[model samples]
Target: MSVPVLRGMRWWDIAPVLDLEYELFPEDAWSPGMFWSELAHARGPQATRHYVVAQDPAEGRIVGYAGLAAAGGLGDVQTIAVARDQWGTGLGARLLTDLLQHATAFECDEVLLEVRVDNTRAQKLYERFGFEPIGFRRGYYQPGNIDALVMRLHVHDAQGTGNHG
Candidate 1:
């Protein structure tokens, strides 16, 4: 298999991204309008959002995508998804690393995200990236009534070390 290439997501990538989004999160997939709104803020000098897509070079397909929004010294991970076949391939970590890099570029002091409480795989990935559980949003996910686990990571230490500590 060829290594996937990661690049900034654009308006043209929305169609394939939506397909992967729905495939991965059938119950809570983001609507096209939601993605459009996020993309709208991802450009220009005053942009507050960063979104990226991973493309399979061999097949020219979007295999993963991630987004982040930052403001007021904080960044929030909007979403991250990898195709099932791409799981266990470090695609999730790559996507997350990209987001964190963007958070740092956005001068964020901390980053936050919410994951489905039942999605242990994603939870572990976040933990590996130095995020710590902070709280829970009761019944945060719709349709299924799944709770959400809120997690946070400090982007840097006071001394300017880029360590999550």
Candidate 2:
């Protein structure tokens, strides 16, 4: 499959994004209102948040979506999800790479995220990108009270030190 192109989210793209979001996160999917709020953050004055959707160029279908929020030199991975059919096809890695690039663009010192304790696949993915578990959040997830592992990835510049600027 051709690599899906990543681009900014638009008003018309919400339906497909919503579909994928619900498909991947059925129990914990964000509401349309929440997506709208994220869009606001993506376009707000601080303008440090990025919301991107991966799409099929031939048919314009959304295959995945991801976002990151940069605040005071920290980039928090707000979310990332890919259609089940597209999982393990490098789509998730590509989306994550894009989000990390966005973090670098914002010059964040580190990136942070919380993953369900049971999501070993996701944890492995994050680990491959240098994220290390530093703490835990009890009952951080909903519907089933899943615990979360707080992870951090420190970014380094050519100097090999934390990139905080």
Candidate 3:
């Protein structure tokens, strides 16, 4: 199985990323304007965010994407989505790895994220990266009213936190 190419996300990639985003999270997909806002803060000397897209070379399409927001020694995993067809391709881990690496770059002391309570797949992935649940947000997800599990990872404790692909 060939790996998708991972690169810094650019504005042109948002359309394709949004397509995958809606497909993966139909109930709570982020609007284009929300993405635009995030990207607006993702560059230059004042940047505090990192976003990326993974494009399948053979398919020439975005198969996955992830983003990180950092400020005041904290990094938040804003989003992570992988095409349904690419579930077992290690793409999700690859994307998360990118975010964690950036968290370290941003001088973060720790990273945090919210995952749906039912998303054991994602929870396991975070556990593998040394994230521990700290709390929960009731009804954090819209439409379905799903609760969110808040997890945190200390940047210094995550294995290979400084490595990037």
Candidate 4:
């Protein structure tokens, strides 16, 4: 697979994004309405959300996508997914890097995310980015009763670099 280019996700990307979303998280994939709602706040000066799609330039296809929501000096990772075949190709890190950089732009003091307890792969990715396991949400994933591992990453101002940031 070719290296994908990350660009701002648009309303039209919903259909393809949903395809990947359902493929990656069939039991708990986000619906088209959910994505539409997020994109609704993703533009303009008052924007509180940042969403991006990783498009493989050669094929002009969305290979991955991610989103972040910011408010009250805090940022939350809403979602992050990469094509199965693209796993271990560092696309996940690239997508996450985009979100964290945007988090700083939004003046966020910290960022948080939740991963299924069984998703050690995702947990490891977050941990590599200095996300610390803060807590857990019992049965957060519906239809399966899967627990969620909550992780937090404190953000330091751009001018200064912390051990984690």
Clashing pairs for predicted structure model 3, backbone only? none
Candidate 4 — what's its lDDT?
0.92
The TM-scores, one per candidate, come to 0.95, 0.90, 0.95, 0.94
lDDT for model 3: 0.92
lDDT per prediction? 0.92, 0.84, 0.92, 0.92
Tens-place lDDT digits, model 2, residues 24-124:
78888888988887888787567878989999887778998998999899999999888877878878778888898888888898999999999898888
For candidate 2, what is the TM-score? 0.90
How would you encode candidate 1's per-residue C-alpha lDDT over 31-100 as one tens digit per residue? 9999999999999999999999999999999999999999999999999999999999989988998999
Would you list the clashing residue pairs of candidate 1?
none
Q: What is candidate 4's lDDT per residue for 13-101, written digit by digit as tens?
A: 99999999999999999989999999999999999999999999999889999999999999999999999989988899889889999
Off by over 4 Å in 4: 157-165
Winning candidate number (lDDT)? 1
List model 3 lDDT by residue over 14-93, tens digit each. 89999998999999999999899999999999999999999999878999999999999999999999998899778998
Candidate 1 Cα deviation (angstroms), residue 37: 0.5
